[model samples]
Target: MGSATVLTSSWFCVLAVLAVLGDAFLPFLPSGTLVVLAVLKTKETADAPFLLGLAVACASFLGDVLLLSLARRGAPFLRRRLARSPKTAASVRRVQRALENRTNRAAATVVIVARFVPGGRTVLDLAMGHLPERSRRFLHWSAVSAAVWAGYIVTLGWLNSHWFNTTWLSLAVSCAAATAISAAVARLVRRSRQLSVVAQLDEPVEAVEAA
Candidate 1:
């Protein structure tokens, strides 16, 4: 089918929404790839990209909100489980402390950054429910994160479409590139967390030495 015909169809819209929404709950879902594929097919139409981006963004935001609400409702049970494991409880306490220490903007930035990290969105959203921040604040930042994520993926697909001749080639290249980027970001985040732990651990020793 032609780009316009495929992009304008009802099935496409439904599929796009489902892919984005499902990803919120199922981290393994290839929602980003599906979105990129959709954008790749929008080459012939001028308005298709905008409409698709908007729909994807709205669906993503809605999914985040729903996931957050579910997490909020289950927070008590989750807390109980976390408390049973000292390691897990400590990790939760650390995240809570970090979020509590940071300013609103910094915390929101963390939320936005988590959206791009593999499997980070689900974990972060769930943790936000138990964090000290209000739901309104999280929703606001999550909306921005959703929009940014949609735009980033859509733009990547659009650019790849112009760069490559074949749709499959564009999809493959873009997905590979996105995966590499996410891997690198995940590595950096892990490293940062380790360094923070090291610093925290050293603080007591340094204080003892000073005495």
Candidate 2:
């Protein structure tokens, strides 16, 4: 690999970490787009695409743990802040129920799955801390979530690369795809929480809160 390629890859790697870090707490950011472009650049750069995924995943993991720590130390304040958004509020309710053993699903399953559903990660991470799960357990699940989420996102980018010849085009395609998936997941979760038969067995927490 040439020195210029190495330098460029380093810069991209740094940017990837920053974008991933931002996305951890602020899901609105286009971190997936940046990572997709970075992977596309790998064809001309010295860095391997998988390595970029690892860096992004580790940065994401740290961001999650950092947020979890903050929520753990300031549970009362964070809870009030998180409850302001309908999406986050719903996730918080679901997480709290699962963590309290009120739900049939396991807390770990909820935590791991929340990583993909934008805004869901923040709510569930906060819920875990609020429920006061062990630090060891939280970190373990956070790592798993980050790794799996990173793989899924990177795989999407890799697939896009095959369809587009240009980096920008591939990035645009991936971002659009990611946005669509995010919206669909959000809608599905919202509908299930409010309208599903399982949710009708008792008062739906999200529905009542929304009202």
Candidate 3:
């Protein structure tokens, strides 16, 4: 209702878009923190959080598309660089194989889940871009992931506001919580991959034993 609040909300939304978009390429940028700050700033403004969330989501989706396009255009060079690093190359190949083997639904699930894990989004996007056939599907799922991520992050900030009196405290607590969640998701993903590998290894042994 106030002019000051409106101006603050507008400025926060603009910063949120830049932070979210820039963080896609510059991993060091604290985009999540900025989102939380935005939530804190706009908490009193009617419908501000919804609009901010939508803006952040669109920015994230656009950033992902741009990153994927860059990766696709530089695929040959990226492949050559990866090839020089055997371990990294092998890891990328495994991800490609997994994507190729999975159903569209399952692969989309992976894309959605990867958005929660720190750094996972970048890696997966780059890997998906390297596979030209998979790029279109990646875009579709990226949009879903972006919206989900934006909502979840905004909710976290809003929830923190209920418990904390100060903006700095709310931002700090929310960011810490986000980091913890991301770490947990990364751990779960690693465990799932390990279990999958173990299952694959067991298949050959089971066949040998039966024969």
Candidate 4:
């Protein structure tokens, strides 16, 4: 690939990194869509697509780590800030429990499967980071997840590029996919909250014997 082509090739990786970073601080960012479009544009070029994939993977992994670490570290401050409110604590506990139940193997499966599942990929790493497992083990799983995500998107793009001539279409489809994935995540959150409520209801309350 020529210099221009190489630069074009790298554009996807850059955008993917930005998506990861953006999603890190802002949960509403369309990270999944951006990653797909980026891969779609870069997959067919003579440029070194593998290099671009590597860059994207690294960026995503690091971004996830940063987000999770910050959240964990900032929890104390957040707890202090929301001290008077038990609601926030309950919500945090629910999120923590959901993430904790996802074992290393389950996380690996999620990372690979969510590559095409939009918001799922971004949340996977964040959830993984909150696990009680060793940091080294988490890193290993995260790296593998990133690589799998990149490879899946890149390969899909390469296959579709033959029939899809416009990058705009790729972006449009990615957006739609992201929207659907967001809906799915919303449903999952709702269900988790309901489950938490049910679990709480199962507890017994103490009573006084005499008044």
Name the best candidate (by TM-score): 3
Query: Whole-model lDDT, candidate 1?
Result: 0.69
Tens digits of lDDT, candidate 4, 91-114: 445545655665666545444444
Best by lDDT: 3
- Candidate 4 C-alpha RMSD relative to the actual structure: 10.0
lDDT of each: 0.69, 0.67, 0.74, 0.53
> How good is model 2 by TM-score?
0.75
lDDT of 2: 0.67
Q: Write the residue-wise lDDT of candidate 3 on 1-211 in tens digits.
A: 6898879877887888898886665655788988999899889877877888899999999988886887788756555655565654555456777777777888887888877765556556666778899899889999999999999999999899889999999998999999999877766666685323212211101000100
After aligning candidate 2 to the native by TM-score, how far in Å is the CA of 202 from where it should be? Answer: 20
Q: On TM-score, who's better, 1 or 2?
A: 1
Q: What TM-score would candidate 4 get against the native?
A: 0.60
User: Which ranges in model 2 have alpha carbons more than 4 Å from their true place?
Assistant: 75-94, 102-105, 190-211
C-alpha TM-score for every candidate: 0.77, 0.75, 0.81, 0.60
Each candidate structure's count of clashing pairs: 0, 0, 0, 0
Better of 1 and 4 by TM-score: 1
Tell me the deviation in Å of residue 177 in model 3: 1.0
Q: For residues 7-105, what per-residue lDDT tens digits would candidate 1 score against the true structure?
A: 465465567669898776666778888888888766676777788889998998988887678667765545555455454445445655666666777
Regions of candidate 4 where Cα sits further than 4 Å from its true position: 1-12, 75-91, 98-104, 107-134, 174-211
Q: Which residue pairs does candidate 3 place in steric collision? A: none
